[model samples]
Target chain A: MKLNLRVWRQQNTDAEGAMATYEVDGISPDMSFLEMLDTLNEDLILRGEEPVAFDHDCREGICGACSLVINGDAHGPERTTTCQLHMRSFRDGDTIDVEPWRASAFPVVKDLVVDRSAFDRIIQAGGYISAPTGSAPEAHATPVPKPDADSAFEHAECIGCGACVAACPNGSAMLFTSAKVNHLNVLPQGAPERETRVLDMVAAMDDEGFGGCTLTGECATACPKGIPLPSIAAMNREWLRATRKARR
Target chain B: MTLGPSVGLMALATRTERRTEPQPSMTRIFWRSTVGKKTVMALSGLIMLGYLVAHVMGNLKIFFGPGEFNAYGHWLRTMGAPVLHHSWALWIVRVGLLAAVIGHAVSAYQLSRRDIKARPTAYVHKRPRASYATRTMRWGGIILALFIVWHILDLTTGTVHVGGFEEGRPYQNVVDTFSTWYGNVIYIVAMLAVGLHVRHGFWSAAQTLGAGNARRDRALKAMANGLALVLTAGFVSVPVAVMTGVVS
Candidate 1:
């Protein structure tokens, strides 16, 4: 599929970005979105022009590294990641605009590359268990119900992609934070530090400069991992319960 | 900043204890988060939604004719009996509603500002993945604000009434206002916005308040949509009755 592309370009984090147009011809419908970008970059390098810069790794989609808003939709029109999106989704000669994630805390590094370290900081703040490493108990030592285990596993699928933050209108990380909160909080091992965990992680999320969740459901919709929207609600439950429990 | 699985247990323990060991200061930290702001929005929104339901029920009394409708309006002032005196209880309710409205509006505006702050630059291309009702919230709020002002003038304060603006005769004033084309237009338009706003707002409130979970999410959504329709129909029915010459 031959396509016209309008790609964002910026020299560095401090530089202003603009949409620069490019043409990619002789594209195969089976090529992945990242492959298509690679084709475009090869052409740019061949012509002695600066190639569009973007982030991508493990194009299989689990790495959550490839970040771009294609034709305005995060990860393109599908409910999958950009790397998982293929040229077959678009018509020949279609014009696609690619850009980096827009967030105050996520500064543009170059073209489509954005600094998503804010997510890492948020997770560091509270998204973990306080288990010691000397010896380990069997995984089934503490029996967990199917429902709780399922919920935890579902939330555990989050890849810290920053797509939730990018997709939210308020640029809120509630979805992302909630996924992590619920993931471990639901587990038996995660219960020991659950109260302190919620309190600290919420504070960290606030510090990261991500906007609040307004329940737009876009984050859930735009999520490549199909993270359910209610992970946020579950997080809210944990936060509230933790705060009240703190009074004791 | 990331609290990756590799982080030391000592660092995590110290951070957790320092945050939650001494005091309730963690409560303060909680409110500073985007989730905290959303919790505030949900709570204040629920307060207002409660008022809307009551207000609409009171409005439906109009169909019972002037005697019942006027009596209902008068009852609002004398609700608290001799202990509080006339209008005291009404004023208290007004104060509560006013506080909720302020909380909702101010939190909304501040959160929006934070959202914009989170995204310093515009995306080269954009597409909305949220519902229409979800997207219309900000503008819907503005319309409702203006409508509240106009509504008070036309009925409560009698400042911008059509024909005779009787002080005690709320029924007549209501009829007179709706008898005019502009009144119906303003009212119907505002009511429509109200429906859309409530549809998205209530579901969002439920999520933020942690009343929603995987199973409950569907029910909360259905309830929100149902409430919006009922409230809109309830409020608009008064004007429709007046315009059709059924109640006048």
Candidate 2:
């Protein structure tokens, strides 16, 4: 499949960026979106031109490293990560526009790559359970109810890909933070620090300058992991519970 | 301006020093946190929603004729008369509604500013996203606010009433306001805005308050839609009746 691409190009973090157009011919229908970009980069290299820069660690889609807003939808027109999106989703001669995540908290590092360290700081604020460090503990040591375990597992699917932020008109990180909070806060092992976990992580998220959630569901729609929109409501409950508890 | 080893040490020192400062009170913390501010928005929004339900119900009393409708208006001022002073209950409700409106608007304004700041850039390829109600929330809110000001002046204070204003006669006042073409236009437009705002706001508030979940999602959504439809129809009926000379 042949295609025209308008890709965002930035020399560095401090440099101004704009969409640069390129035409790629002789592309296979089976090639992944990343592969198509690879073809473009290879051609650019052969001509000694600077290639478009983007983030992608594992093409398998679990790493949450690939970040691209294609044709105004995060991760393109598909529900999966950019690496997993194949060329077959588009028709021949389609003009695709690709850009980096636009959140101020996730600043553009270079080209289509944005610094998502804000998510890291939010994780560092709490996303952990108190357990022994040296050895693995017995899985059955703490009896987690089936419902709670299921809920926790559901929220644990968040890959921190920042698509939620990219898709949110407000650029809110509520979904990402909520996923991390709910993943641990539901388990018996996470009981001890549940209140502080929510309180501190939320504080960290705010300090990082991310926007507040308006419940537009754009984040959930953009999420590759299918982290449900209700995850945010659950987190709100936990935060309110923690706040009331802390007041005493 | 130059990077030095001492700069790193100075940063570490300041970090440590900041930790030693007294912690803020819980109320301050709650107001400062994004999650907490959302809680405020949800609660205040619900308060306004409750008022809208009663307001629309009261508006429908016009169909009962001037004698009954005027009596109902009088009843509003006379409510809680024996237990409290005349108009005292009404004053209390007014104050409470005022507080809710201010809280809702202030948080919305601050959160919106932050949301805009978070996403500094826009995607070059723009596509229509989210439901119309969801997308128009901010603008719908502004319209409703302006309508509220005009509505109070036209009826409550009789300051903007198109015809000769009379005291203690809400039936004639309602007719007078709706008599003008511009009045009918503004009222109809604001009622539509109200429907759109409430359609998204109700369910969004549920999520913000953590009352929503997968099991309850459908029910909450239905309730939101039902409430929006009912309120809009009920409120719009007043102006429609006046325009048709059914209530004049």
TM-score of 1: 0.92
Weakest ten-residue segment in model 1 chain B by summed lDDT: B15-24
Candidate No. with top lDDT? 2
For DockQ, the strongest prediction is 2
lDDT of 1 by residue, B51-127 (tens): 99999999999989899999999999988798889899999999999999898888899888888787676665756
lDDT of 1 by residue, A140-202 (tens): 789999999998999889888888888777778888888899999999889987887888788
Candidate 2, B1-248: lDDT as tens digits: 78899988988876522245576878988999888888898899999999999998888989999999999899998999899899999999999999999999999999899999998898999998889999999999999999999989989998888788899988888898888999999999999999999999999999999999999999999999999999999999999999888988
Supply fnat for every model shown.
Answer: 0.86, 0.92
Q: Candidate 1: misplaced stretches above 4 Å?
A: B1-27
Q: DockQ each candidate and list the results.
A: 0.61, 0.68
CAPRI level of candidate 2: medium
Model 2, residue B144: displacement in angstroms? 1.1
